[model samples]
Target: MQTTETLFETFKNVLALSNKNNDPSISSERIAEIRKELDSRILPETPLAELGLDSMTMTWIIVKLEEELDVDASGISIFEIFDVQGLMDELIQLRD
Candidate 1:
């Protein structure tokens, strides 16, 4: 089983690769805030919406996952997965 810390670490590793351009426009502080949220609430069953992730941020996150991790997120409906564990499952598949 993946521990909470390991899961966040894995997510961060993939996210680091998500910035293909190394663009300066990306806000490091905002990313840090998200990381802090993930650190505090890494439970598998926790709903992302419950963590204050608005649709826009979620969409951006999915886009990055698709672009950087080669994950086919096109078919995914954010409403379907509904929890951190489901997102982790998708990320695991992409990693493989």
Candidate 2:
């Protein structure tokens, strides 16, 4: 079983990758801001949409999780991604 810190790091990495690819010119300060917001959500049920991530960004994140991390996200429903913890749980279950 992966610890909470490990899961948070994975989540943060995936989001960072997505953000970098989506906006190559994004500043480090902005990235830090994003990370801060991401890190603040310690609760499992924090709504994903509340992160203010765009649809394209989410798609990239899912792809990165599936391809880079080998997390099987085939069963993930966009609507069912109700919280950060839920996504972490699914990733932990599907991680290779």
Candidate 3:
């Protein structure tokens, strides 16, 4: 299991890569920025459990992270990660 700090950084880096061009080094502010981007793009009003990431979006997230972190996010179960925090925790495990 990765530390929560590592999980936060993983989200930051992955979100940064999603933008196509940005610094990979992550920060809390960077993570918040990405959350805003997701809010705009997905228009999520509630938690992921209330509005799970669509299949295409889930695939994109995994693929993008795979490319950015060289981590196989394929093993992650999208259905199980029905919340933003869940997704972050799962990705952290994958990163390790």
Task: Write down the TM-score of every candidate.
Answer: 0.59, 0.72, 0.51
Clashes of each: 0, 0, 0
Alpha-carbon RMSD, each predicted model = 5.2, 2.6, 7.1
lDDT of 3 by residue, 1-96 (tens): 456655555554555444433334666686667666654454212356554345665576678767756678777877765566777667666767
**Ranking, lDDT, top scorer first:** 2, 1, 3
TM-score (C-alpha) between model 2 and the true structure = 0.72
lDDT, residue 68, candidate 2 = 57
lDDT of 1 by residue, 1-96 (tens): 454446556665444433433454767676666556655555677776675555655676677766655667767777777787788777666556
Worst 10 residues of 3 by lDDT: 38-47
lDDT of 2 by residue, 1-96 (tens): 557667777777678656787789988888878777666654466688776788888877887777756666878776677888888777777764
How far is 92's C-alpha from truth in model 3 (Å)? 1.2
In terms of TM-score, which candidate is strongest?
2
lDDT of each: 0.63, 0.74, 0.60
The residue-level lDDT of candidate 1 at 7 comes to 55
